[model samples]
Target: MSKIQAKDVNGVRVLILNRPEKRNAIDLEMYTQLTEYLIQGNSDNDIRAFMIQGQADCFTAGNDLTDFLKHTDIDPQHPAFRFLFTLLDITKPIVAAVAGAAVGIGTTLLLHCDLVYADKSAKFQLPFVHLALVPEAASSLLLAQTVGPKKAAELLLLGDSFDAETANKLNLINDILPSDSLFDFALDQATKLASLPPQALQASRRLMRGNIDGIRLQMHAELEEFSTRLKSDEAKTRFHAFLNKKSHKPT
Candidate 1:
């Protein structure tokens, strides 16, 4: 089953994260479906614009860790890595609607999106340090490129979380709206994008970020080192502690 659901709002295609029960954590299957659509959406003439959002309160709780053990790899050959390529390569206007917790990849992924609307209650983080992994999805470069090295280091190295308001002030997110209105507002904005001169919109986007290209191999190299760290005694201890902490938390 696909963790992503698809629908067309006029000529704009909407892709929503469907695993709300798990707080929209990305499993391997979701990655495949998401990447497939990102690649497919751009090439399809019917799709004039695209939007991505979560199913419920949370944007994504990041990758599903237990599920990631067998399939996760930083190698560009890995399908997961290919998924990042699709996201970064999408030339069309991409919008994001973030609710509740936007963890790890959830936060990094927004760096590539064109316009981001977050719920006032939204929380964001890139907690790779806590997991003993380096940021993947070429986020190490992208985050620093967008937010400057000091701020990026503060988030990625410290594994800290931030609120949507703070994210907007920092220009990390475009706007923070009420949770109830987020998806509708994003769709409305998407409709506006769909009504624009498609070629000019695409051309403008390309012009701004055209110089940034080819981070797949770099991500692969970084993750090889990251996976090695994941297997280390230090990371093993931290991972177990996190699991233990979660186990004791109230559900």
Candidate 2:
């Protein structure tokens, strides 16, 4: 079965993260799938908008550490980078339904979405500092722009998890819905967007987002730093410690 499941509702392309056992942790393969789906949806005229979701209990646990540990050296062609860049380039409106954990890239990816709806079960964290790495997805630039430098510093520097309510206050989410209804609510919103006049809808979206050249530049800078950090001794130690902790978990 595909880790990233694709479905269509009306004109909306819905992508679901399907690795429930891993709490929907994104691996390289999943990243590639996500990129392909977004690229496909963006180019297909029939697909008016895109919706990203996961199981009601989990949006995503973030990247799979096992994959990260094995593939530390990265470039623009890397699956993770390709996925991030795809999110930036896609012109169609993207709506996200986030239920449980949105960690690392999980949280960063939402910054690019046109709309984000979450549930009380949602938990968000940057954790790049904790992992001895730098932020990617242009989060270092966008987070501060979204929530101010002080708050962004707290989120990125401290590397702690915040609840859905807190995320709402930070303007990270449109609203919090009951977990049972979050998916339907997000889908409804995506369908509404899909129903709108396509050219106008896309044009309005592009205008609202303003220039993305800066975002693209920031992503390239982040990629360079992320690649350097991934090869660092500190990052290696942190990754090892993290994996060791997980392996010793009482399972």
Candidate 3:
């Protein structure tokens, strides 16, 4: 079965992350699938908006470390980077419903979303620093811009997990909803966007996002350092430790 599944409701394209076994940890194939779906959805006139969600217990555990470690190159055209870049260029509005864990790019991806709703069970974290790495998805720039440098520093530097309430307080999410109703609520919002005037909505969204060029530059800067750090001894050691921890976990 496909790790990423898509369904159309009215004019909204709903993308479901379906790797519950892996806690929906995105791999290279999943990234490619996501990029293709988003690009296809944006161009299809029948699809006006998008909604991204995962299983009741997880939004995503972040990337698949085994798969990520296998890739020595981290260029702009890399599948993971392509997915992030696709998020930046998508014209249609994207809404996200997050529950359980949203780690690393899982949380950063929310920054590019137009609306985000999380359940009380949701947990957000940026553990790049903990892994001896820098931020990606232009999160270093956007997070600082959204919540100010001080709070951004607190979250990124400490690399700690935070709850849904804190995410709402930081304006990272629109609001927290009951876990049972979270998916329906987020889908409703996306459907509402699909019901609006597409041109006007797209124009308003673009105006609000301001300079795309600046965001692109920030992503490039982050990727350059991210690639370098991926090669470092500290990062390699942490990666090995993480793999070991996972291997020893009681199932």
Candidate 4:
């Protein structure tokens, strides 16, 4: 079975991350599939909105680093980069149902979403600082814009995980629901979005995404720079230490 499952619910196209055992950590194959799905979904008139969720107790543990180190090319045109760019450009409203660990890209991706419904256990982080790398997904810019520079610096530079309540206080989430009911709540919201005026909805979404072509170009450049730094001695040291500490932590 594919790591990313695409399904159409009413007019909401749902993308569910499938690697429960791995906390839905994204690898190259999953990223490629996600890119294809997003591209196809945009051209599907029947789809009015997009919804993303995860299986089990986690949204994602972030990228599968070892698989990434092995298969990821240094180019900015990687599948992961393509997928992130596609997501940022999508005009349709995106709603995310986040539960459990939303680490790294898991959390940054939500910054692009129009609405987010998080489970009480949800935790978010941008660990690039600790890894001696910079942010991907244009999050360095988007996040600071969303929550202001000081908060963004605290999250990005410190790379510490914060809980759902703190996230809600910062207006990062629409609501925090029990894990069991998160999907239902998000689907309820998506159904409402599906019923709204399409042209108006698209227009509003576009406004929020402002200057996307330009932002997408910037993100590509940012990812290229980040990819180069990912192989640096400092990055390798920090990354390996992270992996070692992570490996010993009982999940």
Candidate 5:
């Protein structure tokens, strides 16, 4: 079965991260596939909106550490960067349904979504600092804009996991729901968006977002810093330590 699954429901194109065995951790191929699906959905007139979700137990554990460690050539054209840019460029309304762990990019990517629903059990974290790297997905700027600079610093610098209540309070998520109903609620919200007048919806969305050029600039800046940090000796040490720890864990 495909690690990333795409289907249309109620005019909403649903993209599911399907690698449950890996906690839906994204790899290069998954990033490529996701970007392609988003591009296809954005161009398809019949698809009015998009919804992203994972299995009931996990939204995503973030990037697959093994895959990330193997990819040394980080650049603007990298698949991960491509995915981030594609997500940022997508014009249609995007909704995210999050449950369980949403680590690293999993949490940051929600900033690009129009609406985000999380289960009460959902855990969100930005562990770039823990990995001895920096934030990506324009999160350094955007998170500060969303939750003020002090809180953003705490989140990024501390690299601690937070619960859904904290996420909602930080404005990262629209609401928190029961774990069993999170996906359905998010999909329903997406369907509602799909049913709205397209031009007006898109126009309002664009207006609400405001200053795309600024966001693009911030993203590029973040990418540059992130790429540089990824190559640092500290990051290499942390990555090796993390991988070794994972390898020794009981299955």
Candidate 6:
């Protein structure tokens, strides 16, 4: 089955992350596909807006650790980097529907979306520090700007999960809704955006995002540190422990 499913709805392109069994953990292939889809959506005149979502139970559990560990060197050309850069460069309006766990990049990517809606049960986390790594996707800079430096430090440093209420309070998510209703609501909002004047909407979006050149620089810096950290002994030990724990879980 396809891990990333794309569909067009009322000029709104909906990309569904469909690996529910793995909690939609993003692997290398998914990264590549996501980047490709975003690039296509941006250039396609028929596609007015984009909405990214996952299964009702999970938005994403973040990177697939096994696949992530297999890639030693992460450069600008890497699929993960391509995805982040594409997300930053996309001029179209983007909306996100988040539920359950939005961990690591799952949470960070929402920072770039024009609008975000989360379910009451949604949990957002950036546990890069716990894995002996630093934040990626320019989240270190964007999160700080969104929630202030101190709260950003508390979230990134402590690497704890925050509920939807906290996410809304920090202005990370626009609103919280019932799990069953979140996806439809986000899609409705995307349709509304799609109905707007495309040129004006994109212009306004670009204005709101401001100068993303600084964000690009931050992403490059974060990728450099993240790649270096991934090769460290601490990271290896943590990855092994995490995999081992998963292996021991009851089937």
Compose the digit string of candidate 4's lDDT tens values, residues 66-184: 77667536665677787887888787889999988999999889988999999888989889878788898888888888888999999999999999999998888889998788998
Off by over 4 Å in 3: none
Clashing pairs in 3: none
User: Which pairs clash inside model 6?
Assistant: none
Model 6 C-alpha RMSD to native: 0.7
Q: What is the lDDT of candidate 2?
A: 0.94
- For candidate 1, write residues 33-93 as lDDT tens digits: 8888887889987788899999657899988776656554446555666677677778788
Candidate 4, pairs of clashing residues: none
Lowest lDDT 10-residue stretch of candidate 5: 68-77
Off by over 4 Å in 5: none
The C-alpha stretches of model 1 lying farther than 4 A from their native spots are: 214-218
The predicted structure with the larger TM-score, 3 or 5, is: 3
Candidate 1 local Cα displacement, residue 234, angstroms: 3.3
- Give stretches of model 2 more than 4 Å off: none
Against the hidden true structure, what lDDT does model 4 obtain? Answer: 0.86
Give the true-structure RMSD of model 2. Answer: 0.7
Clashes of 4: 0
Task: Estimate the TM-score of every prediction.
Answer: 0.92, 0.99, 0.99, 0.94, 0.98, 0.98
Candidate 1 matches the true fold with a TM-score of: 0.92
RMSD of each: 1.9, 0.7, 0.6, 1.6, 0.8, 0.7
What is the lDDT for 135 in model 6? 96
Any runs in candidate 6 off by more than 4 Å, and if so which?
none
Question: Each candidate: what lDDT?
Answer: 0.82, 0.94, 0.96, 0.86, 0.93, 0.94
Query: Model 4, which residues run further than 4 Å from truth?
Result: 246-251
TM-score of 2: 0.99
Candidate 6 per-residue lDDT, tens place, 1-251, comes to 89999999999999999999999999999999999999998999999999999988899999999998899699988888889999999999999999899999999999999999999889999999999999999999999999999999999999999999999999999999988789999999999999999999999999899769999999999999998999999999999999999999999
